[model samples]
Target: MGEQPILEMKNVHSGYGSIKALKGVSMKVMPGEIVAMIGANGAGKSTTLMTICGIIKATAGEVWYDGKKINKLNPEKLPTMGLCQVPEGRRIFPRLTVEENLILGAFHRKDKEQIKKDIQYSYDLFPRLGERRRQEGGTLSGGEQQMLAIARALMTKPKVLLLDEPSLGLAPIIIQQIFDIIKDVNKKDGTTILVVEQNANLALQAATRGYVMETGEITLEDKASALLENPKIREAYLGE
Candidate 1:
């Protein structure tokens, strides 16, 4: 691991109005590693992701990405800095073609040749997306849309990918497939990934390190294998 983390949140605090979602939450993701944030509903997992992506601003502490303080940067600037987020719910444009959606992801880039190459790369990664390139985004299945969402994020050529609940609402087999692709992306592209998931087992399997959050606090942080073996984790989150 590098001396400086690729992404870091130091005692971050944020929420909607008076409701504080994150209370002194701190975490870090090193280069080329998959780090997971696992937590129950309302535990601030999603908030943390949004905060880091600049969708939500932190009232306290700082968010550092690639040695720059990004806590104050607007959301639009994040993609340009090699930070891309696939938000929850697979938010694809319903009326747009699959290719159009992917193209929108690279709107900040001016290099047409590079964009073309990235589009091809994304298509190669998910053949289904290529097959449905002309189809409207709403026509795809939930699993296919999830794939599209990921593919669109990848079109930005992000150095650090922040994935929020990629497995939500998908079939078990599809979830497995998505996780496999995520691992492949990390291995092949060296993209640092920070994933927030409710599926503890799946997240741990894909990540090298994991953190367990509860009620806006991280109660456990350890190696994925260690967390998987923990009695409390198994009983509380793993349903063991």
Candidate 2:
């Protein structure tokens, strides 16, 4: 068999109350690979990421990380296991300074020295954050806030990073910058990433493989290059 995947969801069924958002969805991300989940609104892309991060509990099926089932783990427990998520809409603390917000990302850890090192690492990763370290999170531009959010997530030292809609509402140039940083993080830190995005073109360009979800089901799975050339994807998502 091929090398075991770093993260796997097998026939996952989850939703709010009785509304099923994910129906038997199964996907995997191998170590050091950037995997993209692309779909339109209400396609269950965000739900998949939330379920994986334990923000939304899976009512059925299994989620496995490092060969162990984690469907029932609480969200607070996930960070300790090296699973972190930078949720949709940069959820930084508007009232807190940039430095403080980043520190909160490591709340579960007790190693102050290591946390300080990680903080410096985040600054190295996003120099803009370092420049505005004392500024309130709400004062930063959208792109800057997004960078802080990503940097904060990294403070947890995650092995599997789930990024939800990282380019939600940003300029094309800023979006390009974010994608570049994501690839850099993957390449340099060996962080396995599972990204949910509506920007199919950019997402496919950055990822090694991708899955297309429609109405809570994965309708297509292929190498990023293959999906980029797909006629249906071009017509529907690529706006060709």
Candidate 3:
């Protein structure tokens, strides 16, 4: 068998109330690889990430992290287990300073000194954030808020990073910058990433492999290059 996946979701089924958001969806991310799940609106991409993060409990099937079953794991305990997520919207604290918002991301850890270093590292990654360290998170522009979101998630020092719609509502230039930083994080930190994005082109460009989801189920799985060249993918997601 191939090396075990760092993160795996097997036949996961989850939804809100009676509305099924995911229908037995299954996928995996190998160590040090960037995996993207791409689909249109209401196609269950965001739901998949939320389920994996335990923010939305799975009603059936299993989620595994480093070979440990984690479907039943509490969402609050995930960060300590080296799993972190940057949700779709940049949900930084509106009233808190940028620095304070980032510090909150390390709430589960007790390494005070190391936390300080990581904060500086985050600032280095996004100098805009460093310049606005004392500014309220709500005061930053849309692009800056998105940067802070990614930076905060990095503070957790995750082994696996789950990103939902990182390219949403930003200018092309800012989106490119975000994806570039994402690849950098994967390479430098060796963080296994499972990103859910509506921008299939960008996602495929950033990932090693990708899954195509439709109406709550994955319909295609292929290497990123293959998916990017596929005629169907081009017509549907890449806007060819």
Candidate 4:
């Protein structure tokens, strides 16, 4: 008898052929929430995002987005539905110019003028990106590439943005800059986020709610602040 969730997974089971990466995983993200799913390597965090986006099919259960079941929807149609994912490794087109990469994110939209405005919006979000808008994506530093990847996703004006390993391989200061932008994006754009990160410390610090996954199953979940103080979480994830 409360507001329905914006994105949810109900007893979802998925994997690569026989791998069984997720075992009845269940989670929900409310409107305007920053929900962090944290876990170690091979914990199936990335798999969860991929499955929700339809790149990895859910063998069982449901993935509900906005208000409908999307487990079976065509993967290419997800962006139009406002569920956008920025996957691991900052997968931007190497030969494409920074501006060109950003435009591709809005490939589904016909609002050419608004897309142009959003391109400016992204530059404002990451000024470094604006400086290199004409440069090839691969020529940018790792941090800049990450910025372009996020900027590209924002072009869709997604309702729920799924981020996987945004901090991976970046320097600490750059990681800080990226996370700061993530919070700003959540507040300024009012976009809900579900981030999966191996850096549990930073993820918990940024999220309002947190979920801990181990061996493909979620083992702990609570308010972000509460989880930060949790002894189990401190020892396991926070490296106490």
State the lDDT at 220 in candidate 4. 86
Better candidate by TM-score, 2 or 4: 4
Model 3: lDDT equals 0.93
Q: Give the alpha carbon lDDT tens digit for every residue of 1-240 in model 1.
A: 788899999999999999988899888899999999998888999999999987888999999999999999988888999999999999999899999999999988899999999999988989989999999999999999999999999989899999999999999999999999999999999999999999999999999999999888777899999999999999998999
Distance (Å) between predicted and true CA of 47, model 2? 0.6
Runs in model 4 with CA error above 4 Å?
Answer: none
RMSD list, candidates in order: 0.9, 1.4, 1.2, 1.2
Which of the predicted structures, 2 or 3, would earn the higher TM-score when compared with the native? 3
lDDT by residue for model 2 over 125-237, one digit each (tens)?
88999999999999999999999999999988899899999999999999999999999999999999999999999999999999999999999999999999999999989
RMSD of 3: 1.2
Q: In candidate 3, which residue pairs clash?
A: none
**How high is each candidate's TM-score?**
0.98, 0.96, 0.97, 0.98
Sort order, TM-score high to low: 4, 1, 3, 2
* Residue 70 displacement (Å), model 1: 0.9
TM-score of 4: 0.98
lDDT of 2 at 34: 94
Error of 2 at 54 (Å): 2.2
What TM-score should be assigned to candidate 1? 0.98
- Which residue pairs collide, candidate 2? none
How good is model 3 by TM-score?
0.97
lDDT of 4 by residue, 1-240 (tens): 129999999999999998999999999999999999999899999999999998999999999998999999999998998999999999999999999999999999999999999999999999999999999999999999999999999999999999999999999999999999999999998899999998888988999999999988988889999999999898988889
